[model samples]
Structure formats: structure tokens, C-alpha cells
Target: MSPPARARPLSKAAFSPTFSKLKTSIYTDSLRPSAPVSSAHFIRTLSWNAPGTLIATGAADRTLRIWNPEKTNVKNSTELRGHTGGVERVAFHPVNETELASCSSDGMVRFWDVRSKAVVGEVKVGGEPFTLAWTPDGSEIVAGRKDNNLIPISRSTLTTITEHHQPVQTNQCVFTWDGSAIFLTNGDGCVKILRYPSFEHFYTLNAHTSSCYALSISPSGGYLAIGGGDALVSLWDTQEWMCVRTLDKIEGPVKSVDFSFDGSYVVGGSDEDNKLHIAHTETGEYVYTIDTIHPAAYVAWHPCRYVLAYSAEAQGLKIRSTMDVQAPLNPSTLFSVRGLLVVITGGGTSIGLAIASALHQNGASKIYLLGRRIATLEKAVETLKSSSSAPHYVDVLINNAGVIGPRNGIELHESESISQLRGAMLKDWSGWESTMAINTQSVFGVSAAFLPLLEAENIRRHWQGSKVTGYGNARHHSASALEKIGTDADDSRLAHIITVASIASYIRRCAAGLVDNASKGAAAHIGNMLSTLLAEWGIRSNVGRPWNENNIGGLILFLVGNGGTYISGTVQVSDGGRLGVFPSMY
Candidate 1:
């Protein structure tokens, strides 16, 4: 493998990448590619244009499709149909931008006006032209014949410039990044490099024992990624032509390979089971695998953007936007609550019970239910323990259990007399103390009982997450501060007190009585304030546990997942849009 001639060393500081459509390699399922943009068919080849404005694909359907990926939904695609047989390859002119050329088993090289979908030029190459490419300068077109010659023709004249003889069973031909050399892949497991214009052989490399299929040069001319019938994508250093790394573990022959625009990532596609692999170029570590995309026959990275376009066994073209936001979906996925030790204060009934069940069903490590009724709590525990997969343990605490006040404490009685109205207000007065006690004052007792456990867990996860994310050694950097303060801050488990509050907390509402609304609202604010007060202890607080039946549990699960750590002082609404409709309590 040759070291890079023009490639710069990777930056020492990690790059914080912004999401650029799905092509940048983000780790969230929220932005995955939808179903294929086109219907099902055998797509032969796909290529993105120079400016990243369009994608061209040739299909076994004997037709060509031009896609405009800028449209988010990609609804406006133009079809060009002049080929009488299966199209083999499509190339957008590197310099001309507006023109594209395609070759087909139909025995012709046709030039196209990308906008009008009209053929501006055509040349009949003898026999079927299987592969085609444009010179980096866009001065000529080169088509590899099914026979033994590479035909280079002038772009302006559409006349043959020269025919370079290649060994029989040649698969494809490509130019180096600087257009300084031409690389040829022969089916006999070798790559031959030759100088341009003079066509003098520079070197012959034994690349693969099996038939070679794809070849791509890094934009920096520093590396080459090649794959063939050998079911591997080998990374070769361009400077020495020595094989630097081999990305194996693929099931079938690799059909295509491409480097990201900046040469940071290598993308490969396998015809076997149609899996696509994205690997970090420097580390040579496989970063992502998108499986079952169908057999991708061709892969092309967008020239100016972080998008990838490919043609599989479908209606021809699939364009994927890549981003750098890659989060693994395992036990530690972004919105997952798996393996969490949880405690719900009101776990025996109502919304509290629902929260408990949501956590139980989704793989919480252990759960401790807290409620005034011991019998009910026991029953709930048995019910939960019966189906849970992970061992149950008492871990975190939630301040979710609460009560409501009289529905009409602040409303006028329908009774005609003033005496009737007086009774309505006075009847609920004695119960008001209990309402406030259970609804707004229970946090002190519940948190006191479980605060230690929560803190312990926080400390454990701090080290655990830190170690897993490559920050283990850095923890010692803060050891001095911890020793000087003589506090548990460094080893504290981020146990949080999660409070469930209704939307009424932020709005002026008396549906459940002014006092009830006021108490609940105070509870919500207290949860947020707790964070600031407990900042030194590493104990955080957040208000708002969404009910699962209402996608609030989904939000609450998110709050408890990895996302929960970053948030501590906000009121996240999980009300199914009911805040706007203002539904009445029955």
C-alpha cells in the first residue's frame, strides 16, 4: 500500500459533524431512508452529477432515469428512453455538468442534455459497451468494450481519439484522482496502471485472486478501495501501492466501492444479501451496516455533498443522505430505557401503574414500586416480576404518584340558592390538606428513601459511560478537584427525581379547582428547581413523565434514556397535542 501523496493527516480534535441528510452517517433512526424512491426493477448503474444536483441511473428496463435529490420527497424525476436494450453504465461529464453519457448492451454510447432529457450526441461503438467513464478534464469519453479495447473519444467531435489494448476479461477502467494515470481491472485478478496519452504501462498490481469488479480512488489520491469476487473491500495506500487493510466479513462478492467526498469514509456494497457497509477510512473500522437494500450493482458518492446514490434490484435509483450523527441501537440506544433500575412512587395505580408497566415491558433492569397501600404494591410487584427479563433490583426513584382535588372547587354550584354553593366549597375544604400532602409534599419522603440508590447508580453510570465512550483515563483529570472538595460529586450516580405534572401547570386553569391546579403547577416548578439546588451532589431533577398509553411514556422513556442526562431544568410536554384543544375532564 502506498501512503497518500496529497492527503492531510486526520485532525486531532474530533469533528462535530452536522447532519447532512442521511448521507453523513448519523446514529438515529429518525432520519433513516424511507422505502425506495422508485418501484421494483433491476437497476444496472447509478451516478451522481458533478454539482450534486442530479442522479442518473440506467436500468435493465432498457431506460434511463434522472433524479433530482434536492426535492426532499424526490417526486419529480424525468425518464429518458432511447436505448433498445439494457443500459450498462451512466457517467455525468465532469466538466460539462449539463451533459451526461451512457452506454448500453444496445451497442451505442449516447450523450444527453440532463435538463431536456434529449440526446445531444451519439456514437456507435462496435459490440456492446459495458462500462463508461468521463475524463477528469471532461475532454474525452472512455468506454470499455466487451472485447479487448478501451475506446477514448473526443467530447466535442464524438470521434474516437485512441483505442488502448487491455487484457481479455477486463472489467472496468478508472483514472486516478489527479488524472495522472489510468487504472484497469482485469478479470484475471490484476490491476494495471498506465500513463495517459502515451498509454505506457506504469505498473501491474496483483489485486485479487478472483475477478475484480469495482475500483475507486480517494478524492485526495492518497488511497484506493477495490473489491471483486473475493467478498472483500481492500484499502490500498496510494503512495506505496501496498494493501493497508482488508474489510472482510461480507458474505458475497463486493459489487461497488466509493470513498466519501472528503475521503473520511469508505462505502461498499455487496451483491450477497445486499448489505452496505460504511467504514471510517483512517481507522479501517466498520461503522454502519445497512442490510437488505437489495443487490446494489453500482454505488456513487455525491461529488459535493455527503449523499450516496446507488442502483439496486429496484426501479433503478436510491439516494441516501449521510450524516455524522451515528448512535448505536443496542441496549444503549438513544431513546431506549433498557437495563435501567427504576422506582415509581405511585406504581400501584392509575398513571403511576401505567408508567411502571411501560418500564417493565421495555426491559428495565429492576423496579421498586412505592405506594401507601402495601398490598397493592406487592401485587404490582408480583405482576411485574412475572414477565420481566432482567433481574429486578431497587434502583432509581420517581416522584410520579399524586392526587387531584375537587373538580368544582372553583366553580359556581348550579343550585339556585347561595347556601348550596357554600356547601360545595366547604365540603372539599378538609380534603384539601390531604390533596396537597400527597400531590405536592410526597417528594421529600420518596426522595429520602431512594436518593442514596439513585446517587450510587449515577456514579456507576458516570464511570461506565465514560469508559465505554473512551473517557476512562480522563476521569483522573478531575480527581484533584474531587479530593479538594471532599465530596461524592465525581462518583455520584445521577439519580433523578422525575415528577409528572399536567399541562395545567403552565396555563391558567380551574378545571380541577384552583388549589389543585396551583399545587400541581408548584410540583412541576419544584422539579426543575431541584436540579439547581442539587447541582453539587450530581443529583438532577426533571418534571414530566409521559404516560405510555399516550406516547408520554415514550417521551418519559426518552427522558430516562441517554437523552435524560442532558436535560434537568425544563418542562417537556408529552400531552398528545391536548394542550391546544383544552379537553374537559369527565
Candidate 2:
């Protein structure tokens, strides 16, 4: 060998380097105490309310500080005291902006009233309470302990209603979008999902090679992201809990994770690397990093702005944003529902209500709730009217209202034979008919009912864009500096009728489209979406769509914004590769 081969010199771009290499933007802001007081100053957790204006952080110093991140110089606005041990976690009430709930190593969970700056409710959870989460309705609270126990307590009474024993130790827990289930990251490098209230084991996902430490769900309930000791983040389809993709390039064990306000970028803080990594949720590509210097315990994104808040082990708190966010071409703004009207069937409860809420909160033009129960529909409308800004009309129609069918169904026992099966079918004939009526037949009925409204919305968008290109145009829609940017302005997305279905319907499919759990070779193949793809990644055919389950609000925003123009005639799948995992069910 001739000594060492000379290393090639880095060739300089003769002229413009910016266009040659990808431009990297690092947007970050740090907030620290004026003077360091003690070793207990390490930040442990961070939380933001649904409105995004207020932020709360817990620290080893046993202090909980609340601040307004909107300010240029974020001061430790208000501090709450009472926990004897280090503050471990904080959660804002889903509906109440003024109320916050927190837990600590001191073995206590406290709910604080921001305006009063006092602990309104306190409960002694003990057993080294490390985390806290609120049900979507904010009526109850769940706390995880070091002993592998999950205790759900009433928010009003702050007393344990029930507790569940999760086999593996838990690092984090989160409720699904509709609060139908709770997902947890365990020590076994897996994410476990259990039905809420019923406490049934929904499924388990092998997300990482090592223990998983962080978990987050997108605002629209379409996706779930998990981070772990493997230095990777796995994004999964919420509908079927199938891993969509694995995101890497992290420095060390991922300590915490979060989605940006717009669900475009995913941010995870690394423990050993002491850095915050931001990656594109769709493509799983690296975007930017924020040097945090200390291991971060949690990260929070503002509900409506570009600001991000994270707390590190020793550092106080970091409120980060970058100049790149101000650019008109930011990728995160691609899916938006700026000014589109939405009509959701069965919009009063479950998935229907969840989609309606996501759209309303994110700036849809208007959302109309249609269901059999007039009272429930009216209530939903009232709730939305009170929550979101006023918009013109309901643009998109979410045909999500349907029933799971009869409470009682046929179960197979090894002891039963074909004769028993035939008799059982007859006995359950009524259940079969009812299930088909709601879960199957209703699709046609609801779609036809809302077709006219959707068509009208499309025509309206075309008019707006062709004319002065003014307000409510969706794409190139004028906005304040901090909001998520809209995409390469064009709106062929005319009148969308997003129909929701289940994985149980796929009778045939090509082999390539399905994915599997890690057990049987765990080969995750992207078939013609045998099961989950249709619902996870929106239909890619004639009409442009997002992932299945589709994140209706974001899609509506994009369509209304001139982002999705002239798109139609496609069936989207979001079953999380269920067909791949189980093969054809029939």
C-alpha cells in the first residue's frame, strides 16, 4: 500500500452553493433563569395547552414554571410550588386553558389553576409517580408509576377509579385521538395499545430494537410516532397500529418526541447527544437540529405557532424557532384546511367527532355535524362554534358516522363444528343485518346526501382563486408570520367525499401491498394497501389525498387552500398494513 491515499479535496461550488446543497435552517431560542441557584435547576418536563399560548415546565428544582412563549424574551412568568420531590411531568387540561395537571418524583399529582397560581386539586399517587395524562374529555386522569401500574383517577375527585398493570415498565403513555384506547412505550422495545375503560389488549408493536422511551400522536389521530433507545422514531398508522416508517439520524437514545402544530415535522430530543432532531413525518428525512446541550425530558409544540418548547435535564427551557419557518416554501404546510366547509356524518361521537374537532381547531371554514340524534349533533356544533374562529361554509364531508354493530357476535370455539356455525349464523342474523346497515350501507347514503355541498365548496374555491385571489382562498392564503405555510398554490381538489371504512372488507389483494408485525419475519410490504394503506396514506389515485384516516382537517385545509385542486376518484386506505399482517381474513 502506498502509505495513505491522499484524501480528495472538497470541491467548492464555483458560484451558488445554496442551490447546490440543501439549505439547513436551525431555528432555536433558549430561556434560562437569570441566575443559577442550585443543582436542582435541571428541567424535567414541558407542557402546552391546546390553545398554545401558555407553556408549563417541571424541573428537578421541584418548581413548576408557566410562561407565555409568544413573547420575545420569555421570562419565568409564574411559578407553582408544593411538590416535595423533583417535578417530573406536566399536562394541560384538554378543554380548560387555565388548568394544568402535573406529577412528580415526590409521589404526588397536582392540578394547578394558572390564573389563580394555586394547586386546585391534589392527589397522592405515590409509588414514584413519573407521568400524567388526561382523557380527551378532561373528565379523568391517568398516572403511571414505577411499579408497572397505570391508575386512572377522576379529575374532579382526584381519586383512583381503577388501575391497570402493564407487564413491562413504561416510559411514556398517551391516549388515542378519540380516547378509545391508551398507548404505552415499554421496556421491551415495543409500543402497547390497550382499549380504554374496557382495558382490552388492542395490540403490540415492536417499534425499536431497544426500550422505547417516547410516544406521540398526531393532532388529527391519523398517525402515532414512537422513539426509543435505538436512536430511531417509528411512525405508525393509528387505524391499524402498523409501523409506517422508521426515522433515523439521531445521535443517541431518543428521550422525548413531538409533532409540530401542523403535523409536518417531528421533533425528538436525544439524551446522550443532547440535541433535538427534526424530521419530515412523511418521508422520514432529516430536516434540522437544535443543539440543546442537555438531555431533554420532553418537548412541546405551540398549538397555533412555529415556536417549540423543550426542557432538558440541567437546562431550564428552550423555546426554539428558525428563520426558515418564515419562508413561503416550508414543507410542513402542505396539508392544510384553511377555509373549507366540512360536513361530518355521525359527527357527534368517536372518529367522526375527532375529525370534526381537528378541522375546527385548525381553521376549516366551517364544520356541520350530521347524525341521527339531533341533540348530539347540535351539541357538537355548539362546542365547535365556541372553539374555532368563524368561517364561511362547511366544505368537506367526512362520512365517518357508523356503528361497530351488535354488541353480541358469534365466537368460534374449537369444539364447535360446521353445523354449529350455520346455526350460530342464523341466530346472529339480526346482528349481521344491523352491522351491514350502518357500517356498510350507510356509506352510499351519507355520500349522496353531502355530495352537493362538497361540489358547491369546490366551485367556490375555483371562483376565489380565479378572481382577486383574496381571503379564504386556501393556498396563498395570507396569514400572520408564525403560522404554517401553505404549499405550491394550485387547487384541483374539488369537492372531496372522504369515506371511512375498516380493514375487515378487503377480500382480495396483491401480496406486495401489506405489512406485518415483527413476529413472522415482520416483513412490512406496501401492497396495493391490502389493508392499511388505503386508510393510512390517502388514496394516491385520481384525487390527491393524505395518509389513510387522512387527517381530515389537514386535507380539508389543503383542498380549500388551492393545495389539492382537480383531485378525485380514488379509494384511500389507512388500515396500518393490516392485510399484510394477517393475510386475507376471508
Candidate 3:
């Protein structure tokens, strides 16, 4: 073939030529000492969730693994085991991160809730499903079997909608951007276009000289890519249905193909060792080559970023990023709470209002104040809104509403006569009851009420619903998606609760008062309880002992901001070492 077209400079910065093998617990054989290790279980297919926070991989080991690329710990992955045969393909729902689907060589396709690690649905298609794809709308999934059968399965009801047997051996299938049609690769080196729902053939393209094995549609829906056994990948204009470009540097049959998010480049996986090639779409020139120890069998680009994910034979999943990608941990960017929706209780005055001020100054999107007095809350909201440049804002409750009761236990004990002590104890029993109702009971009541809204916030941001507590549920937000609401993605921080309990919670001196200390202690424990109870639901809870107003405000900013997404279920004592100075058990 003639020399490929000249590559543009933009392609050089789009991705790095060198690919790095991501070390996961499954891939790091050293992490699992008890289990027998083997290099024979190669990855078969992989898919990235809609938010780009997770990657789901299917492998020859008959298991499906979900990975949060941001975490490298031994527990960062959750394995779903049910497939009796080797898994062939895995796909995440187009909009739901928690919902996933996988097909295996045992002639079954199973739907799963990754959080619960339970099979939600399944179907026996009568043939080994070698490929899977979810419609753009996420209402249905299509599974292509090695026996040339194409089956459509409904998301609401896991049963097969209908089965269509293709004339040629089906290798892979993908739905168009509009879900109006499907592009299916087959043994005839041709791409068959079929109208959806009805499964009627629309047209056919003579894409390669040999069996076609791969298919990918550009994000813009303007171009179609086809890979074949002839070791060539062809790009076609979807509108005109004409060949636009041909890429042929592959050393073996192309097994998989994908277009980057912006449609700037296309990558092809080959059966030849280390032959993963990335080419500029406009110029059709090879821009990068990924060297792998084994043949690259599957390739996928993140839906919203430049990061590329691929599976090498027996190597699990690998991820590589471009130099243009910025680190999420940059100090200057980490603490800002921009675009966050917040609600704060007792926010009309004191530390609650101080935190509102911090959030207002820092660019929180929306803020709502909750307090016993509507006038106080309205006044605070008016003042903060007047100061903020952004009109919309929401916030987490500070849970600072409280009341101090009677005298210290020691002082009450000073009464020499039993009658005097009894009088002192009964003097303000009502006040003690009020303190518990406000400080302790309200903390739990308010946080519990907000759980639904918090979970809804995650869904509104295009993330999956909060996971129900169970075996495999864990935090799923990707580092890149956790930054803020931007052109690319929304802030990935989960809903958080920060209760302002006093330092008296842990102080055994009883200097704060009998009911006051007791109520604060209950509030602190409530926060701790919520940390575990709400953790599975993707909500974080923390108790803050606010000794200083400014310290409490800064602490609230950190807890609700992107920097604090990883912190949950702990007591943050901002007492300036007061606990150390006091003769108390802290």
C-alpha cells in the first residue's frame, strides 16, 4: 500500500504511544497468595460505564470483574461469578453504572446489579453469545451468538424480544447512535445493516476481502469502522454509506475496534502480539502503537476522556492516559466545592452559617437552609444569595441545632441533701428532653430524610443509583469524573452529612453539663452509625467537634468538597488540642 497520509500534530497530544498495564488485585498475582495462580485466563471483552467511572471485564476464567481504575488496592475489584463457561462479552448500561450485562460461552446472557453482586435477569439464547451491546437509550440489549443468532433482550423484562438468525457467522454487533439500526459483522467480510425493532436488512457493505470481525460507530454517528480477518480496518461515512478511509498496518486479523470520544482517532486491536494501533480518523495515518506482551484482543476508549482501555491475552485489563490529562489531586483544585448542591440545618447562624459563607464564596451551585425559625433561615438565604454570583445552590445540613441543659453532674452532686439533689434533677427534665430531640434525634431524622434526594442527585448526574448494602457494593466514582460540573462530566462526589456535635461527646469531665454532654454523645454516635448505614447507599457521614467557628467552616468545606469524597464515618475533632488539655477520655 502507498504511504499513509501525513499525521497531524494534534494526534501526538491526543494519546500517549506507550500503554501501561494497570495493576489490579486480579492482575497482581502476588496479592492472592492462597489461590492458585495461572496465566491462561485471558480477558475476552470489556466495557466502560456511562460515567467512565468503572470498567467491566469478562474473561476465560468464567468470571466478570468490575474495576475502578482510580483505585489500585487489593479490594478495589468485585467479581461476579455465575457464568458456567468462559465469558465472551460484557457491557454496562448506557446510563446506569450499577447495571451490567454479560454473555458467556454457556449459551446464556445474564443481567446484573453490580452493587448487589446479584443476577437481576438472565436468558438462555440456545447458542454461545460471543458479543453484547446495549442500546443508546439503555432500554434493551442485543446479544450475538457464535451460531449466527441475533437476540434482543429487554431491560425491563430480561426475556428475549425476538431472535434473528443471520446468513453468515456473526462475530460482533453494535447499535447505531439513534438506535434506529444495527451494524453486524459476519464471516463474509461484509457489514450487514439491519433496521432495528423489526430486524429487517437495510443494506450491506463489502468492507473487507475476508471475514469481518469488529464494528464501532463514531460518537457523532457520522462514521462507521469495520475490522476484518484481512488485517484491515475500514472507515465509512454513515450518511453516504461510502468508504472513507482504510487502515492496514495490522499484523493479524483485527479483533476489536473503537473510536475515541471526540471522534479524533480510532484504535484497532489485533491478534498479533503488541499490534494495537491507533490512527487519526481524518488523515487515516497511524499515530501510536501500543506494545503488549500478548495479543491485544479487545479495545475500548473511555466514553468521556482520552484514556484507552484494552485487554491483552492473559494480562487482564490495562489503561493508559495522554499527557494532556491533568491530575485530579492538584492542590489548587481539590478543595473547591463548585457546582455542588447543598442543604444545611441550623444554617441561620453560627458555624452553620459560616459554612454557608464558605460554600457561597467557593462557588457552590445551590444552598438551602433549614432551621426551626423560618425568618432566620430566610434571612440567611437572602444574605448568602446576595453575596453569591451563582443564582442556584444546594448544600448539606450542618445539623448544629442544639440546646444546653441543667448543670454538670458534679455540680448537681454538690447538693448534700437528697431532697435538694432531687429538686435540682427535676428542675429542668423538660429541657433535657428537648435537648435530645433536637441534638440527637433530629440529626438522624434529617439525614435519613435526605437519603432519597442524595441518591437522586447521583442519578441526575448520570451516575448509577446508590448501591444497596451487600457483598460487592463499593464506591464506583472514577477520579476524572469527581472533579466538578464541566463540559465533559459532573462532580462525582457522593451525598455527605456533617453533624456539628460538641467536644463534650468524648470528654468524660462532664464540664459541659449532664444532658448537654449526653445529647452530644448521642449525636456523635448517630453520625458514626450513619457512616456505616449510608455507606452502602453512597452517602458519607462524619461528626465534627467544632471548637472554633472558622475551623468548623473549613472542615465543612473539606468534607463536602471533592477532596473529601474518600472520607466517611469518622469523628473529626477540631478542638485545637482542647481534648488533650482536659482530663477526659477522648
Candidate 4:
């Protein structure tokens, strides 16, 4: 190469003439590689020690790797291999950095000593182990298997203590703070609470309609974080075993969820986009999104560090530092009630209009006013439209509307009496048929037609904000935080359903003179039953107070407001103290 042709060196005084350019190049080459490769290897499952200095990861390649990120060596430091199949979950002993537990698809859970790379013990679960959790005291390990059951194993003996029948593919499980109970979710979309050692079924929460894929419990065990295949993450009250709220509106199934050590932030992994969403625990508002291409199968937060680790199919494992992102703005308050189309079977009565109007004033965004007179419906619609700011939200239908029947006594009407009274009763029954057509049949028909709209509104409200809690001029907060979290309009953002059955339905045999007694007894029974059912869905149902009771409207308003959130399924006997005097108590 002609001795590399002596290089020209016309540099300034600052160039350091004593150092040759070729000599500098050789020095740089010696210090740095031309194409440097990453020293970090792919990870699958990750767990950090209490001090966060030691990290453990289970790999898809059937090996347990212990790493000290602080060390520069590529060596795993320790490799454990008792599992023949891929290891899916790993949990470190709370007090021992040298020991950890791992679950694999081979239907086995293994305890490993990291320092010695030895299998300490193992337990055989009947099905593939999908999720594993260590008790707060580290005395036991709870593993959720492919079969919808949770197997609890003693940490020392590696023996099964108890198993729960969950009915769906068990995806995740967590123990309560005191270690008295365990909560588990399965692919069947059900969450169950069981007493720890006895495994007695305490409560079964049927909130989600799809697979519940991930779960996290608050450090205090007051709330549970659940993410499902339905693209919704729900916050459940551990005490009440009811769903308190849902987080982000995701397009994909949620795979894993974890709460920040402080319980202020909730992080979850989604299957749809392989992205992680961080939300505020109090408000369920999105805080930030982690962009990653790998499909994250699981995620766990380091109890002592800012780092979060996730597992991916092709990438194997990855860890990233969570960035602080601004929280979303406080959600808006827009109340909406679904299932508003009610059909009136009997002739048009002022009571029907009053019920519809009351519902409208109580935040029913849509109402189908039904009756027999076209003119009456047109006029009612016009009146409702003019009186309410949300008039366009109302609809009206004319059905067989008329009076109840002739003023004749029941005996006369039932007898073949050829008189005006009999003719009038016949006319009344005709109107009643029309009422049924409009009230009952039309009610069902209208509900079916508007179901999609109702579902859309429900999803919309869920995304808009936390459940509204308070009465008129009352400040709103999450329902659980409120002093009273009822199904009432002023307290909850959940859609409501109101069924206006006649006070006559409760009047036990009206043929006798004891009409008042029969009616009172009937009303009380209906109210109690309805109240119970509505509570199940977080809705409140109030029957009309006794025929002529004062404060009926007030009671209705209250039940549909902040005071009624917890009142459900039971009938609110609108009848006065008369029903209370009955021997039967609901």
C-alpha cells in the first residue's frame, strides 16, 4: 500500500502534533468494538429482591436465570433447571434472596435456591400452572392452573393444602393481606373468594362477561384489580365482592395487571397492541402508555424499583424504566339512563305520564311515552320537549289508551248482566288489552330495539369517568369513596331500569272488603323482591307508595338519587305504614 502513503497533518496548535492520527485510530479501535453487541440477554419472568439488587427470571427455554444487573458479565450467575417445560411465572421469597419459586406449563411448581442452582422442592399441580403468587408471609404459594382451580401449596413441604373450584381457566390469583383468604379469576369471567386453609366459597363475583385474564390486589386488600379479555379492567371491592369501577377502554384483552407499591398507580398489559397502560387507582384515568412491539404475556412491578418487566414470545423478556406521564384530566359528569322505552297496556293514565316525567327529571336521557290517544301522546311529547333541556331525547308512542273499565262492581261485571255497567266493563277490558299491547308488549319490543344504543351508552359512561356520587349540588367522587354509594341517579353513573307495576297487583283478593289489607300486603311483597334483584345489578327499584301516601315523589327521587345506590332488587313499598303492620316482614 506504498507504506500507507504518509498522511498529511496540517492541523492547528490545539491538534496535539505529538499524537499521530494513525496511532489515535489504533487506540480508539482497541477501546471500542466496530459493531458492538448488547451484553443483556432476553428475560421471561422477572422478580426483584427486597433491596432490588438481585433479580430472578424464568425463561421459555426451560431454565431459571439469576442476574445481577450491576455486574457487567454476561453470565446468568446461576442457572436452575427442574422444569422440563417453559417456566411461566416466578416469585422470590420475601426474606430470602437466594430462594424463589417458579411455575411451568408442565403442571409443576418448583422451589429453587438461586445461589446453589439447586431444586429445593416441587409440587405437582394437576393442570398447567398459569399463575403463581406467594403469600404475604411467604408461608404458602397459590398457583392458578389451566383448569379453573387454585391450588395452594405449603412453601416448606411443597404439599397441596387446598384447591378451589372456579369453573373457568384460572389465569390469576392473589392472597389477602392477612392471608386469611384468596381471590382468583378464571377465563369464565368469574372472580371467587375462598377462605385460605378451608377453601370455603365466600363470594362469587359475576361481573365480567368474558375471560378475566389478570388480577392484582391492593396492598391493604380493600380493592382488587382485574383485567379481562373483554378489554375492560375492573376495580372490585374485596369486602363487598362487587365491581366498583372499570379502567381504560381497551381494544384488546388485558393479560396482566399490577398495582404500584404506593397503590396510587395501576399498570396493565394488553394483548391487542402489546402495550402497557398505567392508570390512576382512584379515578381509573390513563396515566401513560409504554410502546413495545412484543406481545407481553405478563408484567410485574419491582416492589422497590421503578423498573417493570414483561414476557414476550419472540423477545423472551424485557425490562424498562417507567416514565412519569401526566395524568388525564378529571372526567366529566354526564348522566344517562338506558332502557327508557315503556309500553302502557291499560288506557292512558296521568300516573303513566308522571312516571315517565319523573324518570326524565331524574336523568333518564331517553323516554318512550306510550298511551292510546294520538293527540294525548303528541301533546305529552310537546310538553316534555318544551319543559326539559334534553327534549329531543324523548320519544312517544300511541297504544290502546283508555279508562280502566265501567264503574260497575266486580260481581256485576263478572255476571251476565245486560246493562250499561257490563258494557262499560267490557269496554274497559278492551282498553286494558290495548294497555298490555302498549305497556307490556311494546315495552319489551322497544327495549329490544334500543339495546344496542343502551350498551353503547353504558360503554361510553364507563370511559367518561368514575361512578358519580352525590345529590343535587353535591360534589361527585367515586361511589366507594362516597358516604353512600347507592344505585340512585345522584350517586352512580350506572344505567337504571324502572318497572311501574300497579298498586292493584299487590291488593290480595280485592273481591272481599279487605281491599286495603290485601293491597298493603301485596305491595310490601313486591317491593321487597324487586329491591333484592335490583341490588344484584346495582340498580334500585321503588314501587309506588301506598295509593295515597305523602312524600311518594320524594321517596322516588331519593331512591333514584345518591341515597339509592346501595338499594336494589327490593321493592320499595310506596304504600304507607299499612304494609309495615302486616305479619309478614320482607
**Candidates' RMSD to native:** 18.1, 22.7, 10.7, 22.3
In order of appearance, the predictions have TM-scores of 0.50, 0.55, 0.57, 0.46
lDDT (Cα, tens digit) per residue for candidate 3, span 1-586 = 1111111113233334333322212343235555654654667788987667788887777868888877645387898989999988898887677889998889998989999999999999877888887877788999988778888988887788988988889888898866799888989899999999898999999999999999998754667999999888999998899999999888889989998765667998886747678887766877777676777778898776567888755456777753333322346546787767778788888888887888888987777777899888889988897333432322355677777777657657577899887775666676887788998999988887777777766555434454543332223332222223461232446667888888889887666578888898899999999988876666778888877778876787788775675678888888878788887665
Backbone N/Cα/C clashes per model: 32, 46, 13, 40
Error at 253, model 1, angstroms: 1.1
Candidate 1 segments exceeding 4 Å error: 1-40, 72-75, 322-586
lDDT string for model 4 (1-586, tens) is 0001111111122112212121100001112334442322234466766445566776665766776655424353566777878888888876565678899989999888877778889999967886887876687888877766777889878799987766556777777765688777866888877787787888878857898877888643567898888888899876677777888656588877886543545777775666777666666666556666756656776553335666544444555532222211112222222333333222234655665556556564455555556787777777666232332221212122222222334654365656754454444343444443433444445444443443343333221222222111011122223222222222233334444444444544332222223333443344445445433222334544424323444555554443343344445556555445544334
Q: Give the Cα lDDT of each candidate.
A: 0.66, 0.61, 0.74, 0.54
Least lDDT summed over 10 consecutive residues: which range in candidate 2? 1-10
lDDT of 2 by residue, 306-413 (tens): 456776554456676433323234344456666656676788876677677887777676677778998888788887883344434335656565554432232323
Q: After superposition, which runs of candidate 3 have C-alpha atoms over 4 Å from their true positions?
A: 1-268, 272-295, 299-329, 374-395, 408-410, 413-424, 466-491, 580-586
Q: Write the per-residue lDDT of candidate 1 for residues 1-586, one digit (tens) a residue.
A: 1111111112212222322114422111112355544332466677776666677777666768777775534346777889987888888887566688999888889999978889999988878888886667777778988887888888889988878777567777888644678888888878888887677999987888798888888765667888888888888887898999988867788778888655667787766647677777766776666554567656787764446676556434566674323411234455556667787888897777777888888777677777889999889988888343442233356788777776664454354678887775665687788888887777766666665666565444422122211100111111112223332211222456788887667655456675677778878877877766654455667788463455656767777765454566667776666666764331
TM-score of candidate 2 to 2 decimals: 0.55
Ranking by lDDT: 3, 1, 2, 4
Give model 4's TM-score versus the native structure: 0.46
lDDT of 2 at 183: 89
Error of 2 at 118 (Å): 1.5
RMSD of 1: 18.1
Q: How are the candidates ranked when ordered by TM-score, highest leading?
A: 3, 2, 1, 4
